[model samples]
Target: MKKKLISMLMIAAMAVSVAACGKSTPSETPSETPSETPSETPAEAKDPSEMTIYFLTKILGNQYWAVVEQGAKDAAKELGIKNLVVTGLASEAEVEKQVQQLQDAVAAQADAIVLGPVDSTAMANPVNDAHASGIPIVIVDTMINTENYDAALMTNNVQAGKDAAKEMIRLLEEKGVKKEEVAEVAIQIGSSGSQTIIDRLKGFYEYWDANAPQTWTVLRDDVKVNDGDISKAVGFTQDFLTAYPNLKGVFGPNNGSTVGFVTGLKEANRTDLVMVGFDFSTEIETMIREGKFNVSTVVQKQYLMGYEGVKQAVELAQGKKPATKLIDTGVLIVDLKNIDNDDVQSIIKPGK
Candidate 1:
C-alpha cells in the first residue's frame, strides 16, 4: 500500500512538470497583427503658395512701361501669383528711389524681383543684397551689369539700332539725299548713363561705319543727351535743327527723345528730314500715319519683356532655371507701309 501511494505522488509531479512546459512564453504580443493591405507611401510634397513678386520698372506712367506692366499682370494672373507689386519712380533718373524700392523689397522678403534698373551701376549693391537673402532677380527692358541675376529679358538694342540705321538710310535715299549729299546725321539719347542707349549708339555707329558714305558726317557734338526728359529732348532736337542746317537724318533711341524729335521737327516744319526712332506712342503712330518726316521707329517687345521677366522670376523662385539666361524679346521696325499688318498691329498694340 505504501509503494502504490509513492508511485501515485511521482505521477502527479510529472503531470505538473508537463503542464508547466506546455505554457507559451510571451512572444512580443504577436507584433500588431500585420495588416492584409500593404502600407501606402506618402505623396510627394507640393510647392508653397502666396508667392510675392516685385515688378520694378525704371519709371511709371509711360506708355511703353504701361504695356510692360500689363504683360506682367497678365502673367501674374496666369501663374496664380497672389502678390505682384508693380512699382517704380516717376522718372528714370531717380536712381536713389529705385534703390530704396529694391531695399524695401528685400526687407519685405520678396520671393522674387523683376527689375528694369534706373542705373545699372547704382542698383548693383541692392541687387547683391537681394541675392544674398536668397531672392532671385530677373532683369528686363534695361540690363544690370551683374551676372548674379537669374535671367535677363530684353530687346537686343544693338540689333534694333542697326535696323534703325538701315531705315534712316532707306528714307534718306528716297528723299533724293544721296550718300555724298548727306551733310550730317544726328542722334538724341535719353540718358548718357543708360546701357540700352549706349548699346544702341554702339550699334548705330557700327552700322554707320560699315555702310554709311564717307561724305556723310556724324558730328560728335550732334549726339545730344536729353536726360530722358521730353522737354529736354525737344530742346536738343531744336538745337540740332539750328546747329546743323543741312542735317539729313536723325535717330532718337528712346520714347522721350523720339517724341521730342517729332515735336521739334513738326514745329520747325522740317518734315523732309528722315527720322528713325525707338518705341511707339499715339503721337508717334499718328506721325507715321500722317507721313511726317518719313519716320520709322524700332518697337521693342515691351510686353514680352514684362511677361518673360515675371515668368523667369517665378521659375527661379520655384527652384528652376530658365531655358536661357538671356532671353532676347526681339524688336520690330514699324512704318506706314506695314503699320496696318496684323503682325505690326500686334506689336504696336501689345495689350490687344
Candidate 2:
C-alpha cells in the first residue's frame, strides 16, 4: 500500500509540471499570429537602367585614362545602365573646369558620379556639396582632400612610390652603381595639387631616406611639376640632364611625365641613367624591351578603377554602401625580364 501511494504521488507531481508548462502567461503569449515574418518580404531591387551616371576622368586622350574610360563604359554596358555620360578636361590642371562639371552634374541631378579629381583640395568643397545634395561620388585614380566621397578606387600610391624606389635601386645596382657612389635622382610629377602625386613623392622620399646610401640623394628641392604637360616635362628633363651631370636616375610619376623622361633621355643621347616611371604606354613598353638604359615602370590597374568606380556608384544609388570607402587597385613593377611574361603583358597591354 505504501509503494502504491508513493508511485501515485510521483505521477501526480509530473502531471502538475506538464499542466504548468502547457499554460502561458498573458505577456508570454503572442497576441495573434503575425501576418508575415519580417524575412518573408524584402525591398525590391532598384533598376540601374533608370539612373543617370556621370564618368568624369582627370583628363582625356592619355592611354591610362583611356583604359579607365573603357572599363567604365564596359561596366555600364554590362549593368545595362541606360544613361552614362563620360567627360573630362583636356588637362589634369583644369581644376576650375572639373569643378564646373561637378556643379553641372548637381544641377542635372545626376544619380551618381564617377570622378577622377584633378586637384585634391580644390575638389573638396564641390565634392562635399554634391554629397550633401544626396548624390553619390565615386572617385577613381585620384583622391579628393575631403572624406565626403562615397567610394575611392585608386592605387596605393605611397607603396607604389616605395616600390619605384626599390626598383630604381636595383636598376642602378645592375649598372655597377655602388652604395658609396655619389649620384643624384630627379623626380617629375604631373601636378603639385594632386594628392596622388603628393603621396607617391612622399613614399619615394620616405623609402629613399631610410634605405638609400648616404651619398645618393633625391632632388627634393628641385622636384619638377609638369602640370600634365609632356612638353614641359621633356624640357624639365633636359634641364635636369644639363644641370646635373652626376644624375644617375630619373623618376617620372605619371603617364605624361614618364613619356617625357623617355623621350628626353633618347633626345639627349643618354644611355647611362636608370629610368623609373609610372603607367604603361606603347612608348614605355618599347623602351623597356629595346632601350639601352635600365628602364622599368609601375603600372596600375586603371581599367579596374573605372569598372569598379561605376559599379560602386550604382550600388550607392540603390541605397547600398560600398564594402569599403577605399579600394586599392594595385600595382605591378614591370622590367625587361618580366615584360614578356603573360601576366605582365596583360597589364601593360590590357585590351590589346
Candidate 3:
C-alpha cells in the first residue's frame, strides 16, 4: 500500500471506533452479534416518522456484523427510519435459520429488508418471497452466490484478502523471513461455501500464487470454521496453534474468527506469530495498536453498509433501481504505526 493510502486506512480505522457500533443509534447495534435476530413484530407502531427496515446477517455472536448493523442503525437515525430487528443465525453454516429470519421479516410486513444470506441458493426462496410481498431486500457484508437480489452492498473482499496478503509479505520481507522456508500458514475461514470467505482465500492465495508462489502455502486442514462464533473462533485458533508447532501466521476470513484468533495468540504468548485477518473489530484494533499482529485487512466503512443499505432499500422500496448490483465498499490495511492516531482511530475503535 502507498504511504498516502496507508495513512488513509489508519484514519478510517480510528474514525470507526465511535461509529462502528450502533452507539450512535439503536437499530444498527445488533440484537445479536453476527447472529440474525428478527424482531417478532419487526416494527414499532409504524410511527409516520420512522419507517421500519428489517435486517439479517450471518451470525449473532460475531462482532463483525455489529459494525454492519451500526452502519444500518446510523442510517435509520439519520433518515428517521426505524431499522427493524437486525439479526441472523449464529453462523454462516445455518441457512435454515437465515431464511426463517427473512420470512419472519416479510411476514411482519417490514417496509424494507436487508439480508446477509448464509447461502446464495438457500436464500432465494425467502428473498423472492419478501420481494413478492412488496418488501425490498438489500444484501450487505457477504454475497449471495446468485444475482437474485435487487442489489448487494458488500466489502471488496477480494481486495481485502489481497491487502492482508501484501501486508504479510511486507512483514516477512522486513523480518528477512525467506518465502520458501514457510512450512505452514493456517487458514481460518469463516465459511468454506460462502462467496465472501472463498474470495478472501482466493485473494490471498491468488496474490501468493502470482507473486509469492514459492514463498507461501496454506495449511488447509489446520483451518477452523467457526461458522461465526467468538468462542468457537477462539477455540479453533487455540487448537490450530497448539497442533501446528511450525505455524508462522494465521489468516481468518471473518471478523469474529480473526479477532478470536488474535485472542488465542495473545493467550499463547506467541507474539511472534503473524496474523493477517479480516474484519475491523475493536480487539483487532487494540492488537494493531500494540503491534501484536502483523496486519489486519479491514472493511472500514461498515456503518455505511447499514446506513447505505437502508438508504438503498428505502429508495428501492419506492421503486427506484439501485445504481449497481454489487456496491463495492472499499477495504483497508491497518497496522501499528497509526492505530491510535486521531485519523486512524476514526473507523475501527471497538464497541463504538
Q: Which scores higher on TM-score, 1 or 3?
A: 1
Off by over 4 Å in 1: 1-49
Residues 37-62 of candidate 1 have per-residue lDDT tens digits of: 12221122113247889999876888
- Which lDDT tens digits does candidate 3 get at residues 116-166? 778766676677767777777788877775555787887787877787777
What lDDT does candidate 3 reach at residue 324? 80
TM-score of each: 0.85, 0.87, 0.79
lDDT score at residue 120, model 3, on the 0-100 scale: 64
Ranking by lDDT: 2, 1, 3
Better of 2 and 3 by TM-score: 2
Better of 1 and 2 by TM-score: 2
Best candidate according to TM-score: 2
Sequence-dependent TM-score of model 3: 0.79
Deviating ranges (above 4 Å) for candidate 3? 1-50, 213-215, 341-343, 349-352
| Candidate 2 clashing pairs, residues 3+ apart or interchain | none
